[model samples]
Target: METGTTTSARYRRFADLEARGYSPLYDDWCTGISDDTELLAMLDTLPPARRQPVLFLGAVRFVGVPLEGFATFRSFVLARWPEIRQVMRTRTTQTNEAGRCAVLLPSLAAISAAEGRPLALIEVGASAGACLYPDRYAYRYSPGPALDPAGGSSVPALDCSTAGPVPFPQRLPDVVWRAGIDLNPLDARDGDDARWLEALVWPEHTFRLERLRAALGVVRSEPPLLVRGDLTEEIVPLVDRAPRDAVVVVFHSAVLAYVDAEGRNRFRETMLRFAAARDRPVHWLSHEGHGTLAGVDGAMERAPEELDGRFVLQHNGRTVARTGPHGQSIEWLP
Candidate 1:
């Protein structure tokens, strides 16, 4: 069978198990089986002596219907065994590449442009506001471009590639505010929230979790202004209150997938209304599924089909950079 088909079958099985109240076990297995290859390989290598213990643990973790509840656990496992087998048959790849890239580079460019200026950055699905700390870190560009903050005061070195070795000047924006909004704002300092954030990280991508931890350290002391509310309900009012002198950039990473079509439409409408009225520059940064955002009758409309696995760096609907899969590496485009 094709890999995609196998993946779908596994997903369905897990979904069914989850629906049938095997969440704990499902979660445990999900967490344990990070790499599909390794997980699939384990199925055949299970020693006879370890079989009962592994099965018992899986049952306890998933159903809370312990080994003592042998009949019930056996029935549940037997019923779902086919799907579980299928799950062990597939491989896992990084799925958040587009989203990660979409949010990172554009925001970095925006922040770089703002320099000394205070800009208000509002992120939808802020989810702990870890990405907001881009200014606090360093970046190494492959093509001899490097940025290291001097004095470690959040002022990054702007190293650009050019003919003459002239120092890249930092241009600071006159900013009056910086904040973020999310339906569920994660407090990195909060233990439970921190754990949830950790759980969301893909097991294969351990670096992401490390980066998240480092970002959290900087943000906890100087927390980004976060509002706990739905973007649809909160964004309009928040935009209305934004200071005119400061540049307003509304961004989201990996969030569009969770919102429905109607929600996206309303969000676009509200942003456009603000843009039209304010005359101040409003930037929308999105790392959503493939599709170009088109200007139609004074509003923006996203194409039904996405740009197909390309990471886009856009500003005011202009494409700045496009890369394959992940955004870790970037090439500048005119």
Candidate 2:
């Protein structure tokens, strides 16, 4: 929760940009400023005329920080700046980039096997629920080995490489149910919400904004169940209601970094408890950085490596695989 002063300061900056009529090219301007060092460095690379708008957007976003941390700032931005909607929309598209999707196959396989039926996914930080539609789309690479029951394992290892584009299976999970949960759920059908999502995107990545618009067209027609609330509080109750025969899969990408340590623990415990109680299958998928917080200028700053690359797939309290950053490849052990 950021202070009102910080929120106001950020809004003012956004306002100044709007007044100047220098809208950003990309929607995920915040991410460009925050995550991608290359993009940040390139901000100065633009000519002075081009650089002003970019700088204004970044400065405004940076000022919006409630407590000088990425998570706090992101939350503040999402809650206060509805006009910045497109930024998030583009971010959703970039997040689902081809490379990242390739990395998710192993987890997909794990969920498929655990259900002993097919998979129905629940994404916590679904953004716009783009990745949830993996089954409906086509991928260019090949999937790894199928689950082997003879291995005396509840989950089988997927054999895949992490170097390049991996092939995804044409077969989608049965997908009896597909739902999403987010603190701020974006409804593509709602023009205002759609605009807010777009504002969340960085101005530098124009392609992502385009993808988001295209994705939104599809989502508007077939929207997933998206609930707005705290994930730690809402997950257990939701899982309890899931169909008994279907596997309960909970996944999040790049969202855990925003939650505090206590919140993270509570979310993990809640999911674990729910899975244990069901005596059925459960899968937890996450792509987030792990690390410790350090004190900087009397404020807590997370270590850079804290959020380094790692894709985790866990089932029934067991970790199936711990792979590199991109979800394209994995090293799974039964």
Candidate 3:
């Protein structure tokens, strides 16, 4: 009957995470704090802005967990709850990690080569739009070629090793134009916005934190054209404005989960209609959870060992790769 009660909505979230094996660490915390008033109140620190699980953890990381143990973690969270809450209110956990570019690079390059020119990328839910500049970053794919930009950014290279007959990218595709649509876009140049982006990275995954900073360095010079609006509403018009000479590739990574079933269907229909109305081909690229994005052939999903994590990379509705949630690496489908 209270926010602190196990049956209350807030405590239920902790219970859900515990039930699902999110982490032994989280499972332990959820179990420990299920009835603790101080801890429950700490969880409620952030205003009603829909904070993600990572926000609480990141706060400890952001403040430097001082010492390990559950006691230390709880103290840090309670001590800095206000600061964490402020950030949670101001920054959405829109972790736009670019590590995925490594998995996406081969397909994009292939598509660009087949077209004999560059491709204009249109990313929906392009929070901070870091993934939009995959073409501009350098890459190292194990058991394959090393892909690099003409004048590569000093930003840490995207290292993705693939299995099977996946063809290594000959080169990064030429990106003639690019744009991203977001409800609230974060500018890489803005210190606070950029800091929040870095904060969103999971605490233990230090490499991811490094990658975010590296990515920010690469795109800061030439800021991405990120428009503020819903994906379904802003995508088509932005696509219309892109260079007719270049192919239009509509893409998203780990974003469709935010959209309801109807919204996802509407987004799919919108792209189909936009392509139908245009003479040039409009390729749609999706890298999301297995069932999060529709049109994956059941073959990939049916395979047992191949699926490592939730996310799958698809090219125009066909499954290409089953990947880790953050694209730490991937298992390419031949």
- Sort the predicted structures by TM-score, highest score first: 3, 1, 2
lDDT of 3: 0.72
- Among the numbered candidates, top TM-score falls to 3
Report the candidate with higher TM-score, 1 versus 3: 3
Taking all chains together, each candidate's TM-score versus the true structure is: 0.60, 0.57, 0.84
Q: Candidate 1, residues 1-334: lDDT per residue as tens digits?
A: 2343343344345535432252444444433332345333444343332222224233332332332333454455456654433322321111222224222543545554754345667777777776565455555444544554444533222222222222223422333565777776778788756654544444445566566566567668788788988888998777667776566777776565556667777777766565466556577766543443332233334443434455555555455554433345444554
lDDT of 3 at 129: 80
Writing each residue's lDDT as its tens digit, candidate 3 over 200-284 gives 6754557777888888887786777999998978887898889989988988888887787777878877766655655677888
Q: Which digits, one per residue and each the tens of the lDDT, describe model 2 over residues 1-334?
A: 3333333334345444442243432223443333434333443333333334333454334334332434554555546544333332232221332224445654575467645677667878777676565444333333343422222221112224643333334344556677888877767787756664555456544655565676666567678888887788777666666676677688776676657777877777766666666556467766553331111121223445534345554443354554555344555544
Model 1 per-residue lDDT at 270: 69
RMSD of 3: 3.8
Model 2 spans with C-alpha error above 4 angstroms = 1-101, 142-170, 203-207, 292-334
TM-score of 3: 0.84
Clashes (N, CA, C under 3 Å) per candidate: 12, 34, 0
TM-score winner between 1 and 2, please give it: 1
TM-score, candidate number 2: 0.57
